[model samples]
Target: MVVIGAGAGIGLETARQVRAGGGQVILVGRNPERLEQAARDLEPIGTATFDATDTDRLQRFFQDLSAPVDHVMVTAGGPFYMPLANMDLAAARRAFDERLALTLGTALYSRDKVRAGGTLLFVGGTGGRRPGVGMAVMSAATAALPALVANLALEMAPVRVNLIAAGFVDTPLSASLLGDQLEARRAELRARLPIRRVVGPADVAALAVHIMCNDALTGATYDIDGGQQLLPH
Candidate 1:
């Protein structure tokens, strides 16, 4: 299995779960330091460092693989946070391009490289499903992700494709994005969500591994968001 965006979040946890399931894992990310740390902790078969937006490098990386991997999960995306009133058009375009390229490029390049019965999984956001204030561009991109994966599932039959649409996962990335408001947001969700807690990386990773192992699951967008969708907006 190859886990793109294997940093200190859902990506790393997914890699850990796959490894725990006795599968060899290859961790991919743009940050060499984080990759090194993850490699040390997870002891994956290897690690690859490349900007996921670099189409050429991404394609070549898969092509050079010694054998077709059984699973590939992409949890890579950049931070795009701001209300429409203060939105930066240029930044939104860049965010959209990077998000689409990473998801689509991986599917396009790895479609043939993934063995039959293998899985291609993507991580999206619940904000797309229930778009709220301060997440206009991100919500749009997130909404587009599952649609892209659904098409890939049809086009790449026998090679299952699915997406995990998560919400407010408690990761370093989320903390970074939320800054001082992280705990406040967690409190809000705990008070209001059906699950009564913030969704964590382990929660999302477990679902991801399930999707990878379940052959019958494809072209689906599974929400692992602590029932955030059930709450009133």
Candidate 2:
């Protein structure tokens, strides 16, 4: 397995689980220091630190792999939310481009590098499915990812492609995004989510492993949001 964003959160947790299940992993992350720290506990077979948005570098990483991997899971990047009034057009363009490039680049470049029947997994969000103050761009992205994944699954065939759509996962990224409101947001989710708790990286990791293990699952988007999207908005 090649686990991107393995420095922390969902990626880190998923790598841990895979290793625990007797699988070897190549850990990839953008932060060198953090990735080094993460590799300490897992002792992954290899570690590469680079921003996945660098499409060329990503392609090189796949091409240089000594052997084909059984699975590739990318949990890199984070949510981008900006209201039209306050949006920085340049930043928005980077956000959109980076996300698409990372997704499509992984699918395109990993073609011959992933063993047949292996899976290509990507993470997305369910929160952006609805329209709101800062969700215009996100809503569009949320709608597009699964459709893209579905097509990639067909194009890749034998090598499955799937997406995990989550909402309100309490991770380091969430803490950074929510900042002072982190606990408050947790409280809100706990009070209203049908699952009665804030979703965590472990929840998503378990779902990710399941998707990787299940051969019948492909060209689909699995939602793991503690019923956040099912609630009335």
Candidate 3:
């Protein structure tokens, strides 16, 4: 299994679960230091350093995989928390590269190597489904992710393609976005969710693993948000 964007967020947690399930995981990240630390935490697995937005480098990295990989999970995207008016065009472009372009590149470079019946899971967010003021670009890219998965699933018959539309979870990525208001935001989000609690990384990881292993599932978008997306604005 190959996990792109395997930093300390959903990607890291997914690595942990895949390892726990006896699956060999290769983590790819942009920072060598963070990648090394994550690899240590997820010992017995492999790690590689590469910028998720670097298309050429990403293609090279995927091509160098030991052999045909059974599963490829693209969890490379991060939050670009800025109001529309304040959003930086460059930063938004970078975000799209990691979120959407990376998926495109991965499919182009590694699609042939994905064994028949193998799975490709894209990790996007609920903001894509229900756009919020500060999540414009990410929301747009993620909302299109499932559609891409659906299209890929059809074109890559026998090779399943699906998406995990995750919501606000307690992770480093969320921490960075929420900042000083982390706890306060969590509380606010919890009140909105039918479950009445913050979602955990483990909560998302479990569903991701299920999608990877379930042969019957294809082009499915599993909402692992604890009913947060169902809440009224």
Which predicted model would earn the best TM-score?
2
TM-score of each: 0.95, 0.98, 0.91
Residue 55 in model 2: shift from native, Å?
0.5
Per-residue lDDT for 109-171 in model 2, tens only? 999999999999999998788889988778888899999999999999999999999988999
Whole-model Cα lDDT of every candidate shown, in order:
0.88, 0.93, 0.82
Candidate 1 C-alpha lDDT tens digits along 1-233: 99999977999999998888889999999899999999999898878999888889999999889888999998888558888888888988888888888888998899878999999998888776566787788878877988898999999989999998887899999888889999899899899888787889998999998889889999989988788878776
lDDT of 3 at 54: 86
Ranked by lDDT, top first: 2, 1, 3
**Candidate 3 residues 52-167, lDDT tens each?**
77889988887777788888888876666768889888988777766777777877787877899998888877766666787788677877788888888888778898888888
In model 3, which runs have C-alpha deviations exceeding 4 angstroms? none
Clashing pairs in 3: none
Candidate 3 has its poorest 10 consecutive residues by lDDT at 123-132
Looking at model 3, residue 152 earns an lDDT score of: 82
Best by lDDT: 2
The ten-residue window of minimal lDDT in model 2 covers 134-143
Error of 2 at 227 (Å): 0.7
Better of 1 and 2 by TM-score: 2
Q: TM-score ranking from best to worst?
A: 2, 1, 3
